[model samples]
Target: MLPDEPRSSADPSPEGGPPGCFRHPGTATGISCTRCERPICPECMVPAAVGFQCPECVSRGHAGSRRATTRFGGGLAGDGGLVTRVLVGVNVVVWLLAAYVLTPQLGQTWSLFSAGRDVLGGPAGIADGPDQWYRLLTATFLHVEWWHIGLNMVVLLWLGPPLEEALGRLRFLALYLVAALGGSTFAFLVAGNLMNSVGASGAIFGLIGATIVLQLHNRGPLAPVMAFLVFNLVVTFSRPGVDWRAHLGGLVLGTLTAAGLMYAPREHRGPVQALVVAGALAVEAALLLIGMSLYGA
Candidate 1:
């Protein structure tokens, strides 16, 4: 029998010999892999888009599972989106109302300060609600001057949509809020009592950290983002009043959180993600407790 001889379709075997599984020659099977056309028993057959294929043909390495994507992670974002747009809109509207209508008054409220006289820039000893608690998140929204808010908003506009798309509405929102919390919380504890902090640099830097973590999972281009992040870090530290500590806190927390998110097996994804988030928050809470012990706040 010639090796290249064409077997009839109705013959039920590759070479019309006794019908049996290719993998298990002793076991007979009528089914065959669609691509390789090797005989596959019911056990070896895996259902594919068109038909069953032998496990060997169907099995793709890590690269084969995902759809082809653009240079950036392409889970979504090309489509005009709601979450990112809405978030940006809120920031813009808030900035407009605060910057124009409310003016200096709004700026005073949305800055990081503890329960004491602010010796540096901010009004001394704001009311308890705005001073201790609200500042953490509100600080994310407020900026000192026009250039400050302008830069942060531009970055958010560019970065947020793609991220929101990749992470889904719930996960993305959770990440942003926590990033802001972690950043502000770090400032509250570590920064000197006199210093006041504002702006979304921490959250934006968190996005940078998330992007880095995601690259590990997806295996995308590294050079561009790395250079960009490094440049930003240098500028953040070198510039006056940058709150490098807030950026560090947000960056670290976001990276760890994203790492937990990407590392989880798809089957047990949610619970694993929750564990990571809870663990991160636990660490923050511990730090808060220590700060309270020392500082008596």
Candidate 2:
């Protein structure tokens, strides 16, 4: 009689295929890929060169497998942070509240409350009043409509998790917050006359920017990501009602932000991270300067 699979109950008969061993009689021999957690059957189970890996593991290896010249972090895959998820949750909640809580009258009244505006001029954004600047952050959590909220949440959720995993949670959160501010600041400068826009697209685009930088810095499975970014940018340009400027502004700021973070040497201790953070802020300040100049002129 053929030996049973390591985790399989059924034994392979003579006419059947190769012999297998069983570590568990009740369970099947199928195993999960060590890398991606996909299941792999016997025929496909190449002798674990390094060791036996299931299909998922095999595929992950393929996706992340770097060429000889690739840099570090090139073979990483999977979500490793919670910041993106929390942001997504908050955005979704705000959207639901916007839709369900607003009575016709309340909707009209609240529209002005949540809508973003230029604080320096025009209607002044929601938080333009004393101690209201917090709205700068809150407004990011707000969305104007179903489609607006839905699309943003989808992108935020999809991209946020993976990117956060790549960068630590705190760093990822910082990235999102900074990106949001960068986008808003850019909007404030570019929409100089009188314009108001609010959404999480800025922060979402920031994640995309980080992904792009990551691809450039360390080559790996970036084709899918690049494709996604290109498609979104195209849609932003092609479609009506899309704020491509804020998107692009966020993209540029985010790219720089990611680059700043990546280049800042982490070798130094306590003071080094602080220094890096400061440097990133200074870079952002410069960007804001550019925006202000553009607007002033």
Which predicted model would earn the best TM-score? Answer: 1
Predicted model with the maximum lDDT: 1
Model 2 regions more than 4 Å off: 1-79, 102-123, 126-132, 269-276, 279-297
Candidate 1 lDDT tens digits, 1-297: 578987443345655665678888767777878898887878898988787998778665334877643232224445535676776777777788777888788877677655433333332432233335666788888766778778887877777776676776667766777777778777656853545778888888888888887777689887776887899999988999789988988888877777776676666776877787788778766655454443432
Error of 1 at 262 (Å): 1.6
Error of 1 at 128 (Å): 6.1
- What is the lDDT for 8 in model 1? 40
Question: All candidates' TM-scores?
Answer: 0.67, 0.60
